[model samples]
Target: MNMTDSEKAAKVIEALKAAEGEPAQIALPILNGLVGLVQGGGEAPLEFEEARSGAFLAICEIGKALHRGQPADQLWAPAIAAAERWQALAR
Candidate 1:
């Protein structure tokens, strides 16, 4: 049975809630990979844009985890730091 995207996302969120240790360890590499694809600038600009959109969705999911009271230091510190650096670069 094929799950819809929302179902898949909900499953991932539930897994993250039950996860032990640093969730960032699992999440960051994926985010970094998406960012790399966006920044790499290959022939498939649309694919890169899709990757960038995925990265944004990942960031939102992380933020949702934070809002749901995941420990900031343990699960999300690196993500927060990376976001800060990105903001700094933008300014």
Candidate 2:
């Protein structure tokens, strides 16, 4: 589905309210929403955009590790850190 930047930002904010669990284990929709805010069409700052990519890479790493039967913990530290960094930059 296609959505404007405003629509994506709105979705991200709305989802954030309902995503009050482990930061590492955040809902995929939240991550999707975030990607919407940072993609090629997005106007996010370089730092924010980079942080978004880092968060995604961390998630992918966790998935790969899990597929290999290795223990994975949300890629918690890296993902959460990237989130915090981007959030700060966005502000």
Steric clash pairs (candidate 1)? none
Give each model a TM-score: 0.31, 0.51
Residue 48 in model 2: lDDT: 59
Alpha carbon deviation, residue 44, candidate 2 (Å): 2.7
lDDT of 1 by residue, 1-91 (tens): 7543333334433343433244556654444433332232334345434543443454556655655656555434443443333333323
Q: Tell me how candidate 1 scores on lDDT.
A: 0.43
- Candidate 1 stretches greater than 4 Å from native: 1-44, 71-91
Tell me the lDDT of model 1 at 56: 49
Off by over 4 Å in 2: 1-41
lDDT of each: 0.43, 0.53
Question: Candidate 2 at residue 84, lDDT?
Answer: 55
In TM-score terms, candidate 1 sits at 0.31
